[model samples]
Target: MLSRTLLCVAFASASTPLLADTVWLKNGDKLTGTIKVFDGGKLLLNTKYAGDIPLDWKEIKTLESDQHLLVKQDATTGEISKSLQPAEDGKVTLANGDAPKTVELASIQQIMKPKPVVTDLVWKGNIDAALDFQRAENDTDDYNIAFKTSATHGQWRHNAKGEYNRESQDSLTTTNNWDAEYSVDRFFTDKWFWDGRITYKRDTIEDLARQRTVGTGPGYQFWDDELGAFKVGALLNRTDFEYSNGEKDNFYSVSGTWDYNRYLIGKKVEFFTNGEVGKPISGVADYSLETEVGLRYKVTEWASLNLKAEKDIISGSDNGDLDKTRYTAGFGVAW
Candidate 1:
């Protein structure tokens, strides 16, 4: 009976999964979890009891993990280590091959899981939808949906986005519009890139019934990491517009565009904004501006609540000027 009990215990131990990553803090607290990633001066750990916890890199005294991870010490160079071993204070040992290497924690720029096969490809995006309906007195209905997606491989990146909005009051259409855009970027260096984009928009009820644009320019990528990303560009565009009465106009324009986002509060909240502004060389339109700003609060790992505001303006159009603004609160899923 004693032998059988020992055999059962050994089998159970062998079948259990291991969560062996450990971190020792400067304040004498020790934590056990799976190391997720380290970026922007924060080391993220996934704990069974507390979900994900972000520890300041400066507060970590030492850490150990058996998982192979990529440790980047600089912008252009990195190495994959078989395991991380605790070294002296403020240092870590990369146990790779027979010769173990030790380095200062402060010198490590980033740490993440190494993807051997698909290391060059990354994809991420989000979708949001909002709707409002009322049945008292004058009936009303409003709906908005939008999606943006991007993928990067090697030195090239591709982006696509689309949005639809519709509203009705008293069984009459008050607003109806949709837009779509696609863009590509080719990196000349780590921070510099060339951008080419095409966009189309249509509004059934507005004076400016349709718009089409094509543009190309140089852009600067300030930074892109686990925390967030920011980029800005200047574009010279060929634009065409069709009015509700079928009047057509075309012009050449110069524009500035920007996209930015940042994560905060242990990745629980995010702030993002992107926009473009342009002035026409001819009199088709004096100036045009389109922009959106938004915030998202993560309700769970993959779910969020979002609030957004958008503005569109076109001055000096032959069919008169155009201006519109919208605000929305909605739910979204992101990855």
Candidate 2:
């Protein structure tokens, strides 16, 4: 009886199978793991021992899995299929337990695992803060905190951002500014979108106590890819402002905005700039412009070091020298 029990245990151990996705490399290396994603020239693989490994897609000669994945080469050619067979001569065969389909290596843009449960909405963003204090002969303090969050579902996206800044010297506040904005973008085509935004702002240092703006416009994407993207738009804005000098003003404005961002060093470092220009039809200022240029270097998956410079310009205002420039360097986190 003891011998039969040992034999049964041995049979069970031998029959238990190990299931994994497989990748064949150009240099005759084989990797077995759970394939997570193929995006931006890289493949993310989750393994039992190594946690997560990022492999260059160019180095992979072929991939195979029993799992179903969605593959896309262009706008119209996309399908969900079972597995990828090994590559021969820079092409791979996809097997869906039926007749195999072959595709070129270079034409593939994205590969995603099909989820058992459908999920449409996704969220991503970043936040950063900076602080500086000096307590020598004269005490000084400065700080800024900002966060941006975005969500996307199907052809629609929503973004929200907030920022706060303050500065003081010798127990006297020299600067204070804060702003919050919410925006929505609806994509009608690949490169064109319609956007609407609402913004609330306050600046005690600029002698503007409060400002509110609502705008809507069309935007165009010049290019959006793995490396970077550029977008520009124009909006007709209605703004209401209250100044410290007991002046309350409201007017319409023509506003233009530009946003550009690029990634470097395998997407660990990023350079970005976003700016806005506003010309009031009948208000206290002829023109108002604000721009921010920044660099973010990723320290890890969640943390990064960031440096930023900001310039705010206002022309033809009744207030004296409302223009300002500031620089900040600090750390940030993202998920």
Q: Please give, for residues 235-277, the per-residue lDDT of candidate 1 as tens digits.
A: 9999999998989999999999999998887779999999999
**Candidate 1 Cα misplacement greater than 4 A, ranges:** 2-18, 22-33, 38-64, 70-111, 114-117
lDDT of 2 by residue, 1-335 (tens): 99999999999999998889998888988999998777556777878877667778889888887778877675334667778877686687888766889998788866776544434344667899999999999999999999987775556879898999999999999989899999998978667899899999988776778989999999987865445568899999999878888888788999999988887866689898988999998856889998999999989988999999999887887764467899999999976
Which candidate has the top score in TM-score? 1
lDDT of 1 at 320: 94
Per-candidate local distance difference test: 0.90, 0.83
State residue 65's C-alpha deviation in candidate 1, in Å. Answer: 3.3
Query: Once model 2 is optimally superposed onto the true structure by TM-score, how far is the C-alpha of residue 53 displaced, in angstroms?
Result: 13
**Against the hidden reference, what TM-scores do the models get?**
0.80, 0.74
Pull out the clashing pairs in model 1: none
Model 1 TM-score is 0.80
After TM-score superposition, the amount by which residue 167's alpha carbon in candidate 1 deviates from its true location, in angstroms, is 0.9
lDDT value for model 1:
0.90
